[model samples]
Target: MAWQLHYTSARRGPTGRAGFQFVAETPGLPDGVRAGVTPYLSYRPPPDAPPSPDDSELGLFPVSLLYDRVDGRPLLLRCSYLGRDYSGRYGNFFAHAVVAEPDELEGVRPAELWHAPHWTHRPEPETPVLESLDELVPGAALDPEALAAWLSASGPGDPYALLGRLVDAVAGVLGRGHGRVVLVADDVELVARWIAVVSYSLPVAAAARLSFVTYTADPDGAAQRLVGTTPAIWASAQHHASHASAFDLRKGVRDGDASRFARTVAGCWRGPDLAGLDALGELAPLNDPAQEAAAALLALCRGDATVTAAEEGAAAELLSRRGPGIPEWVWRDLVPGVPSMGLDLALALHERARAAGAAEVARQCSLRVTEGVSDALAGASALAEIAAAAGVAGRAGVPVDPAEVSAAAARCARRGGGDLGAALAGCPGGSRDALLDGVVAGLAGARERERAAVLTPGNCDLLYAHAGRLRAVPVIACAVLASVGRRRPGHRIPVTGELLRLDGETGGEVDAALGEVWSEPPSAGECADLLDAHGDAMARRPALAELPSRTFTRLAFPGGDGLTEPAALRLAERVREVMPGGRAGRDAALVRAYGKAITAGPAGAARALADLADADGATPQLAGEAFVGAARRLCPRPPAFRAELLAALSPSARARLGARWTAELPGRARAGRAPLRGAEVGQRNELVEVVLRLRERGVTEPALEAWARAAATRWLAAKQLDVHLARSPRLRASLRDLLGDGPPSRGGR
Candidate 1:
């Protein structure tokens, strides 16, 4: 009996782009088995063609001949398009012989076989499904028997497993050369089966040896024509449908949720296992406010925390304890976060500190008011807040002792010793004008006796501590002196000069009188003189002078050029013994001075300058100037020495003395004059030679222009006849223009 492959196409609706159905004629042989001996062909004409089934046929010779022997046994026949015909002779005829039960062959009932020789068949047409074996058998398949047998002697178990084993065998054969193996199957299920079987059979070590798998579709005769007509068969095939399954599997692995099979494979490979956080309670205690505040305060002390939540918490706690009053240290911490801390928070802190009776804290808060002033000075937005705080603190009855405050201020000043001169120099007005109000405030409550005592040697420490702030010194000193003088108008505290002039006669008496009110002698000069004298006294004071030499140096000469000759010499001597050579700027200045002095003349001022320069090479400009002055002075008496002076010029000096060379040449030419009987040949020759040399030496443009103009005029007059023989066109034209067409005259001669 003849058999037929009968199955309904899966009813994926008209909206469905493609559909697939597995014809299971046999059961229990595995899901992939299709066993049949019967083979028939049926064709639907191209959708645009006439609706006639007679146009297509399946015939005897190739199909029926193979089927007759294989009857009752299962056979797998792949039917695909051969262009216009379904005859086996026209296209590729693929038939697999196999064994199956009668039930496996039941649905495959025999259809009519066309045995005619008159019909012509077309060559095999291309179909997306049959193009690559991967489409028929996906890489994720479970059964790889047919594929493995095709690739090697090993019968199929799993495609990847067989692939890995085959790879090792090949590697051994070729000593590890690279290659590829392609497996063709009937459908995607077969491919998936291959991959599944191979992957399951092989150990992880073997599985890793297998590298790549590619899938492709196999199309039937119907699919071939329909392919180019709509969306192609490859895109609308079982292989393509299987891609969703493969993609989902791959995505799940990437997202850490692999298929059970893949998980097993991965587990066997012993790859890294990542697990999520389980115990987050270990970091709980850090969230406590008080602890955080204490930590922040500690961090502030260590300079680790700044203007943060922790710092704010600490500030709040400190303000609560000290009322609104906060110490300078707290302010230092708060300053960076000032804007964020808000004006209300700052004011609240200050008021709270004041209420807590913390005077030191209150003082600290008031000091922060100065910070607002500084910010205002810096042009910050918070200046208004700072000004308001300063006003409030000033009126808060804070009883800040000026002396005590001054002492603290003095300490702050000492910390910025180098900055004192700059601060004083840039003071708004003169120091006297600057601190007059502060001085008046300081003197307001003091008695005359107290003021006198305050101005005496006992308070000298305070005055000396702030010596650099000359702005404060004069006003304070005047107030103290005026107060003391007012109290005892007739008091004659013998001055030191008076005592010294008296030769010890009134020394003890003056000392005793001064001690009566702890007063000092009145100076001969008035307040200005006293201030000058006070400055002199401060300068001469041993302790102030005993500061580090660098401090003195900075105070005396802030810039490199500010150093005087003596100072430069002193620094050079000191540095030479201490520092290495090749130090530029100050050090080079000294070296240049020393060199200049060595070359200067003995009778000239250059000698003194040279001596000063050579002593330590200080102030090279001075040495150079002195050398020039001395050269000018000695030039008339010792004219020959002029060459030596010119030779002695530094590169810079050479450039400066450039104009002098031309100026002196004429003087040298006119040195020996003669009666105006004829041109002085020797002098004229000398002038010509000098001019030639000047031109050769690349003299400057202006000097050259002047010299050239003079030479042209003189030449024309001296050699009026030679002017006709002038070789230079420019010179000839100029001479002709100046003298016209004149013969040699007496002046010309």
Candidate 2:
């Protein structure tokens, strides 16, 4: 890797100025037959083509960066210096050279590669000077002749700001028709220049198309290996304008900074134009993390003089996750315990994850967290997705609160009001981008299309809606949503209906989506119907069985329409066919179930009550208004049901009546036609029981009267009867035998 150099004099600005050159066939010029060319400059150049803005005694050198592929071997090293004049004139300082075997190749002359048809230059003022980019704007009146004179007279000033300014200008000037732009950052550090360029010139090129190539390990060794393998590279010298001391590849980056870098590139506007790096053709993201760190640091300083420790940590964490190239400084900041500045770094990680197509878990977690933020508590979701995406999950300590980030984003969404997209775009660094497109579509009523494309039909996807996933997010159905895996004891997995609108047009491709699955939970009977529909089919296809189980237990359809009513009826039948006890058959669970079912309507309630009475499983409590209606319906008489309604009144009702049961009854003799419900036997009146049973059996009123009289007289003859009817119509008719012979008066009792 020895080198031979030749010094060339400036043609215009100054004399005796030295710029070096290396021929491809110099015998020791780092291996070559006609080794294309190398522009890893370590020395200053002519005024017309300076190497860097900070080129003091000597600017930064090229590191021999190259694209492994190219079309021809003209191997051009074109250089130009664009400038403006004090007299308000503009022109370029241009120079070029083609490194070749010489005296052989045709159509290969660097001097002929001018951007425009012709070129021109002007004289300089005696003493030249360098100015800031700020001074360059308004009316860019700095020319190359004056710059060259300035370089020779003042001898190189700090190029940091200068080079940055050039990036803005170059992109605009030479940016047209180029979907892609390449910066031949041969100095390795020049990659920093690329990032700066991306920030300023993003208005010109798409981020996807903006990538660069770099040397791995040894630049010289790598170049040597490519001698016979890949085609020779043709490249230009990088015009890096930074004070040499400003760059140190050993430092690390912060997540905050990385995020800022990304944002700058994504947004652009307001500036000048100048071009040159096109000689670079195309380049990739810097292979070095330092570039990112450097760019981020620069951005940080630009925004604020100081950065927080948390900001550094976040950037470092994001960088470390991306690759092993992060220096120790980036992974952990020198100073710890700094509070977070914002979610920029974390958001950048998400953006990068999305960009690399490596963060489904991260995306989900992010969405889940956001959902949680919207819901005050972020409900039951887990952070597995975030961990997977950021590569810090399960690790000892990585302050990742997907929910917090999401909550902030939700607030941001609300703040924007009418235009969520604008809000998203305006958010500096947040997961809004990850969920933006989906949320926007969701709010626009496109969920159905998205659902069909992403899900399977007839299948609910509550696969992750429980105590640990898909918690209660406020904007769930608002289009933006995320979910997590959930678990419960002895339970079946459920299909959670998605909240956002589907993005795809056809469910044909949806794995197993179902639109109807998201509807409200069915009434008990409806659930039973659903269960029955899947019945044995569930055994063969367990999924069907699972669906019923979810409906019966796990799935909490919104409250209404008499939940589990049908199940109650079904269970009652089951009890009669199974249990033999009396009220024991009307256990607590049965009571609740049947009671709920009775609320459905009068007819259904009457049938259920009749069935219960036959099975001796009826409770004293009438379930609701419907049950009362059912009782009054059949009798037509004021005292409707003949099922001993008063006898079956729940204990609570009896306790509430206290002595009123007797007092109220004795006084109501005139209004003896009791409520449609049957009578109560106050003192173990067997006659009343017989008459009620007979009435229940459809006995006519006369038959009921005969039955009651016969039973009552026999009881009265055998024992001193102490009884009264609680809810019987014409109590005197029922109490005749015991009251007669005395001709009981309807007078004062």
Compute each candidate's TM-score over C-alphas: 0.20, 0.25
The clash count for each model shown is 46, 58
Residue 669 lDDT (model 1)? 32
Query: Lowest-scoring 10 consecutive residues by lDDT in candidate 1?
Result: 275-284
Candidate 1 whole-model C-alpha lDDT, 0 to 1: 0.32
Q: Per-residue lDDT of 47-77 in model 2, one digit per residue for the tens?
A: 2333334324223322222222112322323
Best by TM-score: 2
Question: What is the Cα-based lDDT of residue 709 in candidate 2?
Answer: 42
Q: Give per-residue lDDT, candidate 2, residue 571.
A: 37
Give me the overall lDDT of model 2.
0.31
Candidate 1: stretches off by over 4 Å: 1-162, 165-181, 184-196, 199-749
- For each candidate in the order shown, give its overall lDDT on alpha carbons: 0.32, 0.31
Which 10 residues in a row give candidate 2 its minimum summed lDDT?
Answer: 130-139
Candidate 1 structure quality by residue, lDDT tens digits, 1-749: 21223222323322343222233222233333332233222222122222322324423111211122233343323232222222212322222223334344332211101112211132211221111111111222122334334333323333233333332332232223333323333232333333433333333322323332212223222211001111133334534332212211111112233222232222222211111000001110212223234334323433442446434555456445543333344544544443334323344445655665656655565555445433332342221222233333344433223343333223332222222233333333322222223323343344555444435442333333343332233434333333343355342222322222222343354334223322432221221232233323322323211211222133223222223345444444433443323222234343334434333463332333334334243334443443343333343433224333433443344333434333433452343222223434433333333333333343323443344334434433346324433555543444344345654244322
